[model samples]
Target: MRFRMILLIGTSLMLASFTMPGPTTSPTLDRDLEPVVVAGQQMPSFAGVPLDQLFVYAYSGGTWHQIPWQFDEVQDSTIVSSEDGLLDADDQLVFMVADTGDQASQEAWIADENSRQYPRYEVVVTDPLDPSKRGWVYVYHSATLASSVTQDYVNFDEVQALVTSDRYLLGLMTDHPSMDRLELNGSGVDILDRTKIRAEIQFLGTYTEEDLEASRPAATRDGRVRVVIGSGDLIAYRSMFQNILWIDLTSVPMRVLWGRFSTDLSPTASGSYYYDANTSSGVVVDGVSDSVATSPASDWAQVSGTTGTMVRVVDSTEAGGTPSTYYKDDGAVDPTDTGDQRSYGDAGVRLDDPNRQFTFRTWTYVLPPDQPNVGATYRSYARNPLQAQTNEQYHPDFATAPPTATSTPTETPTAPPSMTPTVTPSATPSATPTPTSAPTDTPTLTATPTHTPTATTTHTPTPTATPTTTASMTPTSTPTDTPTPTVRWRVYLPMLRARGSARNAQNGLVLSACLVLGSTPPRIVAEVGA
Candidate 1:
């Protein structure tokens, strides 16, 4: 899920509307947790479907059950529901894979709305990367049962630019490429050391350096966080600085200091541990002390601290593969000042090949630490995402409809032709579900005015590694959760033996009652003819 890296300036003004960017889209988030998003343009067949008559349904347990869905209409940059009730290029369709799968009941050949459960959710890992996995959902245009109710898993606070997911809370920073706050949802453990989580850049032409700040919130959509910023703060002090833009080998959530997962705040309840793509076993990073410049490059990472919770997020770039875990060199800093951190573990990359512009995509997730599956196959799958084959076919209900399953997605997406600055950052309220259940946030798109409009750039120092610290990967164990599998069913008919051995319609589902005689036994039955 590669998306353009953008930044935005935040203001106290709450957005009047929400979710939509200029003509562009962005920021592939929660590959493991976010819902599946399908834009109107991607599915041409949707053009003729009336907005009010549309519905979303996930295939599971052999039948077609109606699921909840929302139609977010777009007017340039902001989201408006049912405004025009049209499925246009500016609009999108989103739904959770949680309620879909290749699983089907033995009688799937005949299951229908009358036999399926309504408002039930299913949890299945349908990542197309797993070659053997079969996963898909359906979008239907119905005249009779278009859902009248839908649920929201993610929420964004337009003014705070804070994204509250099911598992954690993220507050995007406007002053730099870092966060103002990042906390585990229920534990109240703030993962980031808020005082300073910033990105400093180094340009080669003038050999000058400057700190970049967000320009505005660009795109606004659930499961997508986007902001618009330049190589340097384009509106502040360093206005006359060099035009040279250096694509440092890395650029991601360059978090800061002690209060984070480092030595000062390591989780003690169940010991501390971390996981990375570089190794099969979990590394221990129980924050007993500080370390710097850990494994330089790893595609994915997970951590847990005092709350006994495990959280993970990945950072990658088109310019330099996956971003590395590196740090900036700050020669002068207090060893005791937790707020003024100089060297910290950065998920962002430091590009060896500099470029003026490249696609940078990343997102963090707070996985529930309630699972007993640390050794499960999914962890291994995360380290190496394999490719696979898919065959999507609708339930018997839509027997005439074409199969909607798609092929495996490419690791990196080709940016849309119109690079109209993808939307801005995401946000949320403090309350939400765990990361495993999925969460998201979308702000009021770029159509909303920004708080700050300066054009001068800000100063940021060059990034360098601290030679003395230990590897950032530590050895320890963290907690996790395994979601429950949901199976759907309507009626269970017992196999009635007849005539000393033969069975009558082993799968009995009589369409109507046919008994005519009222015997002395005077027995009666229900409508299902059970």
Candidate 2:
């Protein structure tokens, strides 16, 4: 017993020593930054009253700390001020409202390692229905300020806390059912146009009366929204908090579900939630529910539900396409698993049902470590397999409404000439051709009219049409022309089941460690045509 104990302790030390450097070791500052706003410079007096009293937090030493890092050693003495309104300060994440004196716009004061202020750098925001009622303020940095623009609407209460990476100011907001992402240029001052930016939402729900009031939306660093529903379900909606179009999930059947998404999508001590397949309910996202892990200490419970059997992960149908599954440790997955469940950079769980016909309409961005500034990306899969029982094809639908002449720019112009860009302007996303045609009615399985009974299916285009291309020019300028961007589409398929065309198998999709359910033949196919 003594020998066994000693061996175990030695192994433990080895593991800890290998992992400690990632989270605890201090990263040397790449360079110094100056604050965005300073005093009496057409910027608000943010240092007054409530602003000065608000506590400041920084992510350093591998954790968020209340104590500020003293930068006296790196402070720069030379200060430069310009009439164009540049305020500089020491390194700090600052929040402030813009100054029109008595009628000011919302803005922030960011200080760098060297105490210099960058002032009057207006923060872009969404516009409101009422022109007089300025929407929520979206704080950005001087570098990317000019290129970013404001929409007509914003939900101030749903704003996510801002986090800074070395070069960007990320504005996180809950666009209700949608997820929102906004970028700030880190190099110089520029204005952001409201028309060029968009927020994406993933889930659909109607806030209960109580939730609508108490359950305000919160933005995540990764561009997703986390909200507490009145039902205590603790739901997350991905998108911007401005110009939110809430989905009424009350009538939708066989809702596509998932286990709780942990911060960084890894297991956490705070615990998580899952969709219960047995009861068609929701349960805690725990280790015990997982199907294949032998280690009790590190296991997460499988999401319970009768519908759980239908939820399976699949493979990507094309090259350079994202793996059917997302895994942790690295992007490489074990090629051995027929289901293609292998280790990847991070892991994500998928939920589906075989009994009820389901469809994957859209996906929203989840939060990541360095977002807004750095940006976040995620993968989504096809509809539930349960829905496939009735309709042989449960793939993603990519068809969108026809592009209206006014919705999309006909010609690429150098900039937005003289016109003030509109807020939350609508764009027409072109439709991707479907196997049959986009489903116009509810999905149902019926015998074919031919004397020979066979599965007669109606195929729907996956929801992949949206403006996702990165804007080439910085958002800071009021351009003389509006450059029309080329649109693209993407979709996700699970790797847990087998069926349909084996061609999908060639894609050789992979999954994460925990998600690796011993290989199962491909049961479902997720198709996305751009």
Candidate 3:
């Protein structure tokens, strides 16, 4: 008995030890990674470790430098600047927001990049936006931290300043019932109403977990604000109007596409950006001014201060899918790769994480003087230059790639705007049965193409790529002015098939039982029904 008990205890201990999480192993980090500087270069980098965050490095004098503000917890934090050139050597205020229990712990500091030290934090009067709540926003000279409950806010959450040459734009969110937008003047806080803003957009739904992690909302270097809002799983973008000429980041979609915006441009509010998951590089807009749409249309094009370079967010994985693999430059989707059947309109390239043994180069495209895709496609590639540059000043081993050949996309015919799928009602006796079985009669999908300004084309083509096909074509659907009443039932067959043939058989059996019992003689029906 004693031996058995000891044996059982030993087994339990062994099992516990085996089930416990193993000690964290050192990750294969890509330490040799450098920045992609210049406008026309496309280089690629690879990594084994997941990209935590990306930071951009600038060369000042003979040394490569990143601002000290990018660090977190004695470790390297800022991969790239959220908004650069905001704080000068003297004209900026800095502070930290620390969460302490329910009340926030905020400390004001004077930031100086020259010195490794900062002023001792002075705790100012704490006013809860809600007296019943605990979180608070810490205001500084030219910056602000809206929520100061914990260090996680600083460590993980994207913090950026929405500043122009004169004023700072702030986004305030609180648990209270009333406060949404509150503006603070030198003396007191005034509630600012955005009711007159004609272009305001509300949340699509709650943000998905993946959306929250991959999402980033950026403002232009000039502080034209953009905020990515993820409500539910659906992702959309909104941007603020740039002096009524272009859209600001505040008016852009607050989803994954927003994160694809390159950190290179200021007033990055309205430009279209791409994210290539395959290469893992940020999309760098070339040759186009901040005001031009990747297209020629006003819907996609906006005017801005910077031309010849810009960055907007895009995703090749979700947007380009199979075509993303052909992108060759700096891990970005090669705009000229013939193998790519995906439309470049919404697709952007992605960059790999940086680690040792990894070398990266950056290339930009030299767009033709005229919108090459104009009239033939939805967007024209006229004014946007495609050449890229790299910051290999830190590492000298980077390789430069030659430009690839470009191909024009095949265009699809336009469908009538009202030819969309709609449910029809029918009072016919066979309507229910027909809808339950007909699956092929469903209406087709057609996207209203978004036109870019630089695109020479008169109309923008909507991408038609699906999981099964690589080409972007317009969805082919049955053409009819009006769908029959039974169309609604037929459209629902795909969903009904999930119940399986057994359930369908059971339903048939019940129907048969009811029909026969009702139609047969009483004595015969009673005998069969029993």
lDDT of 1 by residue, 105-176 (tens): 222322236222211112222343443453444455445553534454555565676556455665555433
User: Per-residue lDDT for 154-218 in model 2, tens only?
Assistant: 12233453433322232332222212233323322211111111111123221111111112233
Best model number under TM-score? 1
lDDT per model vs. reference: 0.32, 0.20, 0.19
RMSD of each: 30.1, 29.1, 27.5
Q: Estimate each model's TM-score.
A: 0.48, 0.18, 0.19
TM-score of 2: 0.18
- Compare candidates 2 and 3 on lDDT and give the better one: 2
Q: Residue 138 in candidate 1 has what lDDT? A: 49
Model 2 ranges off by over 4 Å: 1-333, 336-341, 344-530
Supply candidate 1's per-residue lDDT for 126. Answer: 36
What lDDT score goes with residue 240 in model 1? 10
Top candidate (lDDT)? 1
Worst 10 residues of 1 by lDDT: 234-243
